[model samples]
Target: GDPGLHHLILDVTQNGVTDHYQLLLGVRRDLPDRLLHVEIGGTSGDPGLREGPDVPEAHLYDAAHDPDLTRILLDDLAAEASVGPLRFRHTAGAGIRTDLTSLPITAEQSNTSLLFGDAYICKLFRRLSTGVNLDLEVNLALTRGDCTHVPAVLGWIELEPGRGARAGGNGEPVTLALLSDYLHTGADGWSLAIASVRDWFAHTPPAGDDEWAELDASAAGGDFAAEAERLGAATAEVHRALADAFGVTTLPAAEVHAMAARMNAELTGTCRAVPGLAPHAKALTGAFLDLAAQAGPLPVQRVHGDYHLGQVLRTESGWTLLDFEGEPARTQHERRALAHPLRDVAGMLRSFEYAARYLIAKSGTVPPEPGGRLETRAHAWAARNRAAFCRGYAAAGGADPAAHSVLIRAFEFEKAIYEVRYEAQNRPAWLPVPLTSLAHLAT
Candidate 1:
C-alpha cells in the first residue's frame, strides 16, 4: 500500500439495509487529507466495525466539494501521473492546466460531475465495472471525428483492477472519470419539455369557442416542435458519426430472431415481477414475434443505448447529446452490443410521450373519460413532437425512421415494458404513463 493513500470502507444504513462505499483518501503532511474518489465496493458483515468510526479515516474532505482538493486532483491530471493504481491519460493536443476553480454539480444521481471554472466538466463514475465505459468510448470517438453534436472529450482516468482492497476482481481496467468541454448555458431537454407542456396546459382559448377542442400545442407560446426537429437531426448526425467511428455491421436474419427471443425473455421476466403487465402479455408478445418474422439482414451499429430527453441538452448553438452509457441495469456486455439505430429513435419518441403525460399524471388531471380533454391534448402534443423529430431525422440524410415501422414499434414496446417495471417499483403514480403506452401498442 502507498504511504499517503488509504482505502477505507464506509457503511450507511437506511431502513434496515446497509450499503458499502469505498473511499480513496490522499493524505498530506500539513493539509487535510482529501477524498480522491468514492465507489460502490464489496460488502463486509463484520459486526465489530459497526460500533465506531475509524480515527482520521472519517475526517477526509471531498475532492469534488473543496477547491483545494479539486486543484490537487487537477494538478495530478495535468501532470498525467500514475498515482497508486490510477492512471491519468490526457488526450493528445489537449491543453491540460491546473489553475481553475471547481464547482460540484449536485443534481447528478449516478455519477458526480465537477465543473472546472466555465471550460471543462469532469464526471466521476460511482460504480466500478470492468471494461471501458461506453460514455468515454463514444465521446472520445466523436470528439476525434470533430462531431459538433457532442462536447469535446479532453481526457480520462482509469483504475487498474486487482489493486489493493478496491480490486474489481478482473484484469481489465475500469474508467474512473472523464473530462470534457462544458456547456454552461445548455438546458436539459427534460426541463425544456416540461416547460413546454406547462405552457400548453396554461393556454386560454379565445372567447365563443369550445376551449378544450380549440386548444392546440402548436399554438402554444413554448412550442417545442422546432427544437424537437433539430434534436432529431442532431441525433441522426450522432448515429452517422458513431457508425463511421465503430463501423457498421448487419445482423443476419438468424441473429435477429435471437434478438427477438431475448426481448421476449425480458418481457416474461418483467411480467413475472410486475403482475399488472400479465393481462397485456399476449398482445405485447406479438411485437417481438413480428420482429422475428422479418426477412433479410438488418443493419446494426453502436447507438445511444439509453437515449431520452434527459440525455440531451439544448444549447445556444444546437442540441448536445450526453451520457452514452446505456441502461445502468444492464451488464457491460449488453451495453456494448451493437443494435439498430432505431432503438435510440424509439427511446427519444417514448421520451416525448413521457414529457407530455408526466405533468398530467403528477397533477391527477386525467379525466374520468378515457379520451378526456387533458388526455387528448397530451396525446396531441406527443404526436406533434414525435412527427417533427422523425421529419428532421429524415431531412438530415438518415433513413426515415418511420419507414421502418415494424422495428420502431417493437423497440418502443420493449422500452415501454422496461419503463412499466421501473415506474411500478419507483414511481407508482407515474405507472399509468407507460401502462397507457403499452395498452395503445397492445391494441
Candidate 2:
C-alpha cells in the first residue's frame, strides 16, 4: 500500500503592521497511498500567548503555502517590525521592505517556493530542518566571495527563540525562507541543451540521404560543444570560489575506500529496489572494487552536490549556477561534507547523455538496427559535448575529470542507480533513461 503525508493547518496571527501564518505540527500520514503530505493552517488568535505545542510531533513540519500569508509576512518583514519573536532580516540590513500588493505571486515546483512578481523569488523550506538552510548559507557565501555564477540573495525569514520551538532542544533561530533576485532574462540550462540537441538532429539526413547520412557533431549547425565548454569553464570558476570560501581537504586512502564502499552500498540498495538493474549489478561491481583498490591522492572539497543541467541557468552574462542545497534526500551534514569535485562533473556529463537521449526519443525516429545511425548520432553528440566540457574544465585550472576515469565512472554509476530508484518509485516511464546508462556503464 502506498501512503503519503498530508497537511494540517495550525494557527494564524494578525497584529499591528504584522501578519504571521504559523504552521506547527501539520504533517499527517496518508496511509492508503503511503505518501507523506504536509498540512497547513492556523487558528485565528494569538498562538504565542497561549501555546500547547508550538511545533507538533517532536519535529517541525512547515508545508503550508498561501500567497496571502507570504504577502502579509513580507509586508511586516519589510517594515522591520517585531512580529512577536519572529524577526525578518535581509542582506540590506535595515529598513528594506516588500509590498505584497505591488508584487504578483507565482508558484514554483509544487508551490513550495514562490515568486514575488518579477523582482524577487521566495523559497520556503517546506520540510523543516533545525540547522541553517544550506541554500541560504551557500548563496550568502558565494555572494560574499563575489561569485557571479549565482543569483544575489536579497533577504530571508527567520523564527527566533520564543516564536516557536524547533527539533533541537534550545529554541535556536530557524531559517524559514530565503529571498533572492529573480532572473527575468535567464533560461534553464536543461531546456537550452535540449533545444541544442533538437537543432543538431534537425539537419539529420532523411531516410535515404546517404551522402549526408553521418554528419559529424562538430560540423552540425547547432553544435553545443562550445556552450558546453563555456559552461564547464564557469563551473570550474565556481569550484575555485567554493574552495577559496571553504578551504579544501584531501581524502585519505581510508576515506576514499569508504567512499567507494558507500557507492557499492548505494548500488546494492538501488538494485534491490529496481530489479531491472539487477542484471548489471555484477558488471558494475568491478568499477567500485577498482575504485576502492586504486583510491589515492583524492582532493576533496565542498561542491555543488546536486549539479545538473537543470541546476544551471544561462543569462546575458554567462552560465549562472543555481541551487546549492545539495541532494534533498541527504541530511544537511552529509550535503555539507567534502567530496571529490568530479562528482559534479560526472553529474553534468550524465546530464548531457540525458539531453541527447531525450531528444532522440522525442524525435520518434529509430534506425533500422539496434546500434544504428540514431544511437550513434546520440552517442556522438553527447561524447563531443562531454569531451569539450572536460577540455574547458582542465583549461580553467581544475583537474581533468576524465583523468580519474575509475572514480568518475563509479560516481556516474552511483548517480544512475539513484535515478533508477527514483524513477521506479515516482515516474516509471522515465526508468529507461537511467537504465540505458546503467547498461552502458556497467561494462
Candidate 3:
C-alpha cells in the first residue's frame, strides 16, 4: 500500500515578497518502510531515500560509511550544482583542507557525529533552524578569544533552498553541519566522577581504625575535591571569557520576578504531573519566591544553560568544556538569552548532588543499621566537592556562588523538579535520585 498524499507548505519571503510553495511526497511501494521520497514543483527530483519518518523528508543527507554520498555533496559544492532542492556550501580555515575520508558515523539524540580520522569531528544537526547555529558561533567566538577551554573550529556545511524552493523565509543559509577539532584522549566528566565514587564506596576502613571512619570525603582514596576545584576554576575561566566576548548586561528586579514566576509555574505543574513532588512543592516554591526579593540587580551574560558533569571533559591539561548548545529541549531564542552566571554555578552544584545520589542508589551493599548510612556518605562527598568547587570559583576571577545562596538554592530546586519529571517518564527506578535532592532542598 502506498502512503497517501504528504503535503509540505512553506511560506518563503524573499526580496520583500512572500510566496507559498508546496512539496508532495508519495510513497514508493517498492522502497523500504522507513524511506520517504520527495517530489516538488511538479517535477520529481532524485528519489533520495531517508531511513526514518521522524527525519525531515527534504535535505536528506547521510555520509555514514558511504563515500559516494560524501563525494556527491563535495562535488555539488565544488561545481555549484543543485541536487534537487538542496544546495551545499563549504568553508575552510587558513591551513590546507583535507579530502573527505571514510570513517564511522555515530548518531546522538539530536545530531550525527562523525570522526574524520582524528583530524576533526563533524556534527550534522538533525533538525533545521533559521538563525545561526549556536555550536558553530560559540566555538568560533571562543577560538577567536584564544580560550583554550574549548575545541577549535575547522569548517562546516551550510544549506540554502534551491531556485523556487522554500524552507524558511528569505531563503537564508542555515548551518547544517559543523566541523571541529576532536579530542581523542579526553574522558567525559561524568564517567570520571562515577568511577571515583565507585572506588571510594568499595573501600573499607581497616578494623578498629576509628580515624579512618571519622575522616571526611577529602581523606578518601578516590577524593574528587581537588579535581572538582580545578573543574570549578575552569568553569570560572570560561565564564570570564564568555563575558568578555559577549558583553554583560544587568538583570532588573522585574526580570527576576518574572523568572521566579516561571519557576513557580513549573513547580506547580510538576507537582500535579508527578505525585511524588506534591510534598515538597511548598518549600520549593518558597525558594523560588526568594529570588524575587533580592537586594539588587544581578549580572547577566551568555551562559552554558545546561551545565552538568556530562557536558564537560577532563583532558590531560585540565577540564575542557563542550556542547554550548544549551538545553536540547529549549528553543534557540530561549537558549541565546542572557542569564545570571550563578545559574550555571547552581547547575554544576546540582550535578554533584546527582552524581553522589546516583552512586549510592546503585550500590549493592546496605548497612545493617538502616539509618541511611550510605546516603550520609554520599551527602558528605557531595558537600565536600560542592564547597571545594565554590572555593576554587572564588579564587578565580568570579564571585562566590555561595554568596548568592538564595538564587543558587532556587535554581537547584528548579533543576530537581525537572529531573523528577524526567525520571518519572524515562527511568522510573531512578526517581529516587532527584527525590532525595528535593528532600534535602526542602530542609
- Per TM-score, the best of the predicted structures is 1
Error of 2 at 30 (Å): 30
* Cα TM-score per model: 0.85, 0.79, 0.78
lDDT digits (tens) for residues 216-309 of candidate 3: 7665678888989998999999999999998899988787888888999989988888999999988998888788777367789988888999
Off by over 4 Å in 3: 1-62, 71-92, 96-102, 105-108, 161-172, 206-215, 360-370
Note the Cα lDDT for every prediction shown: 0.79, 0.71, 0.70
1-443 per-residue lDDT for model 1 (tens digits): 11234434455669995543445453332343243443222113333322244423223334356675666667777888887778788888998778998888879478878899999999877665555678999999999999999999988888766652343435666677899999999999999999998888777545443665645589889999999999989999999999999999999998888888888898999999988888889977888898888845999999999999999999999999999999977777889899988899999999999998888888655333334666767877888899999999989977687788878888888898889888888889888888765655578
Candidate 2 per-residue lDDT, tens place, 60-97, comes to 22423334335665675676555555667777543444
Candidate 2 differs from the real structure by a C-alpha RMSD in angstroms, to one decimal, of 8.9
Q: Which 10 residues in a row give candidate 2 its minimum summed lDDT? A: 1-10
Where does model 1 exceed 4 Å of error?
A: 1-58, 161-170, 205-215, 364-371
